[model samples]
Target: MNVLIAMDSFKGALSSERAGKALERGILRTSGHQTTVCSVADGGEGSVHALAACVKGEYKTWQCRDAFHQRITVRTLLFKEGESLCCAVEAADIFGLHNCEVSSATAATASTYGLGELLNQLHGHAIHKVLLFLGGTITTDGGLGVLQGLGIRLYDQMGNVLPDDCNPLFAFDHWDEEAFQTVRKKLGDMKLLVGCDVCAPLYGKEGCVLTYSAQKGANAMQMHKLEQQLHLLEQRSARNLMQEGCGAGGGCAAGLHILGAELTFGYELINRYVRLEQRLHTADLVITGEGQMNHQTLQGKLPIRIAQAAKKEGIPVLAVCGQREVDCIALTTYFQGIFTIQQGIYPLHEALAHTEEYLEETGYQLMRLITMTAGISHTVLKNQKVTIAEELCRKGKTI
Candidate 1:
C-alpha cells in the first residue's frame, strides 16, 4: 500500500516539504505503507518556490514597485520545454499585503502597476504563454494599474493620460483608441492565464469590492467609493462583468479578462503543470493538507483538489492541517478524514513555533488509528475532539 504525502505549507509554520516528511516519519513508525512526499501550493504564497522546486524553472529578478510603488526587486519564473515557453508571474510578489501594514491606507493606495510592468518585460521575451499567479496581492485597483503598465493609456475627457493610481481609475474615460486594438497583438499570440482560487464575480453583493475589499483594509466609505467606481467602469467597459473569478486578485482577474486572459483555478493548472494525477492515482491513500481547513478549503482549494483527484481513483484521502476551524463533515464525502495537528491547548504562537513537533505527533497518532482500523473495529468519531480523545485512549498516552 502506498501513502502519498502531498502537503501545502502551513503558513508561518512548516513548509509543505517539511510537513510531508514529518508525516512520513510517523506513518513509517507505525504503518508499513509506502509513503511519498510531494510539495504543493494553491498558487497563492509559496507558489514560486513550490513550482521552482518541481519544474526546475529558471528564476529571474527584476526591479519593480511594491503595492505602494516602493522600489523592490521581484522574482520571475520561466519554464521552457522544447519550443514551448511558459512564464509564471506571482502577483503577490509584486503587490502583496506583506509589503505594508494591512490598513485602510494600504487598501486605498496599493496598486497593480508593478505587475503590469513585469508583464511588459515578459511581453517581449519570446514567450508563448504567461501564467499569472493571482492571490495574496494588496491591490483593489481592478487591473487599472496593469493596463497602464501594458501601455494602455487611460485618458481623461481632455485626452491627457491619467495618473497611475487606483483613485485615478474612478475618473477613467475611454482607453487610448489605438493602444486598445493592438495590446493583445503586441503580446504576440501569447496565452495569458490568470491562476486564482476564488470564484467571486466582478461586481454585485458577491463580488470583489463587496466581499474582499474589507479584508484588504477598506473602510466603509472607501468600500462605497470603490464599489461605485467599479460599477462605473464595469458598466462602460461593455464586457460581460458577471463572470466568475472576476473578484480574484481584488478584481485584477476581471481586468485581465478584459485584456485577453483566460481564468483557471491556480491549483488546477499547477496540478496539470506538475502532472499530479498520474502520481495520485497509483496511491492507496493520499495525505494532503494546508495551514487551515475551513470554508476556504471547500471552495476549490489545493487539498480539496487533491481529494478530488484521489476520489476519481476510488482512493481515500486524509487531510491534516495546523488548525481546523469548521465542521468538515460535508468534506468527508470527498475526504476520508480531516484532522488538526494540535495535540492539546497551547498558545497560537507556541503552536506555530513548534509546528513540526505537533505535526509529527499528529502524524503518529493518525497512523495509530489507521493501524487499529485493520484489527479493532472501533468507529472514529467525525468530531475532532472526540477523534483526538480516541487516539489518546488507544495509545494510552496522556497529553
Candidate 2:
C-alpha cells in the first residue's frame, strides 16, 4: 500500500519534517508500504522551515530584531522553484509569544519592525516574491512598526516624527509619503503574498484587538485603549480593514496590505508549492497531523485541509496530534482515525518535552492496528473460501 504522510510541527517538540519522519518510521517498521513524507504547517511558527523542506529549498538566516527590539537571528526559506526567488517568512519569528514574555505592556509596545527589516533586506537583494506567514503574533501595532522598519516615517500635524510607541501610532496624522512610496517603488513588480490562517477583520468587537489581545497579555484597560485607537486609526487610514485576514498577526496583515501585499490563506500557498493534490491521487492512505487538533483546525489548518482533499479522492485519512481537543465524533467525519501523542496526564512542560518520543510511539501503535486489520481481513477471506468449497462438495454428493 502507498501511504502519504503530511504533518505539521508539534510546537516545542517536533518540527514538521521531523514529525513526518517519525510517522514514516512507524509505518515502515511493519507494513513495508511505500511511504511519502511531506512537511507541513498551518502558516504559523515553523512554517518557513516546513515549506523549505517541502521544496528542497535553501534555508537562510537573518540577523534582525525581535518584537522587543532585541538582537536575534531568525530563519527564512529561499525556494528557486520558478524563474524568481520565493522567500517564506514566518511572522512568529519576530513577534511570537514563545520568543518573549508577552503581557498587556508587551502587547501595547511590541513591534513588527523586525518583520520589516527582513523584507527590506530581501528587497535589497532584488528577490522576486516573499510569502509572509502572518500567524501567532503578539503585537497589535497595525504594522506601523513594520513600516517604520521600511523607512516609513510617521509624523504629527506639527511635523515631528512619531516614536516607536503603539499608542502614538494612532495619533500620527500623516506619514512621510515619499518614503512610503519609495519602499513600494523599490519593491515594484515584486509580489508579496501574506499567508494568514485567520479571516478575522481588523476592527470590530470581534476584531483582532478584542478577540486576541487578552491572550497576548492585554488587560481590560489595555484592551479598551487598543480598541479605541484601532477604531480611530481605521477611520484615518482609509484602508479597508474589514477584509478577511485583516486581523492576522495582530493587524500585521492589514499593515502588509498597506505595503501592497496580497492576503492568501497560508496553507493554500504552501499547498501550491508542494503540489499536494497530485500526490494524493495515487496514495492508498493519507496521514496528516498537527500540534493541536481542534475547532481551530477547521479554520484552514493544514491537517484538516489535507484530510478534506484526501476524502475527495476516496483516500482514508488518519490524524495524529500532540493534543486532541476536538470532539471525536465531529473530527471523525473528516479523519477516519485520530490519535494523540500524550500517553497519560502530565504537566504541560513535561508533555511538550516528551512530544517526539510520544509521537513515535503513537505512530507505532497506529501501524500495529493497521497490521491487525489486515490480518483480520485475510482470515475472513479464508473462512469464506472454505465455506464455499464445502457447499460445492455437498451439492456434488447430493447429485
Q: Write the per-residue lDDT of candidate 2 for residues 84-156, one digit (tens) a residue.
A: 8888888898778773556666765788888888888998777899988988777877777888888788887
Tens-digit lDDT track of model 1 for 45-121: 76766677778578888886777878899888888867789888888888776534577887767788888888877
Count of backbone collisions in candidate 2: 1
Misplaced by over 4 Å in model 2 are 81-83, 155-160, 165-174, 326-332, 370-399
Looking at model 1, residue 360 earns an lDDT score of 82
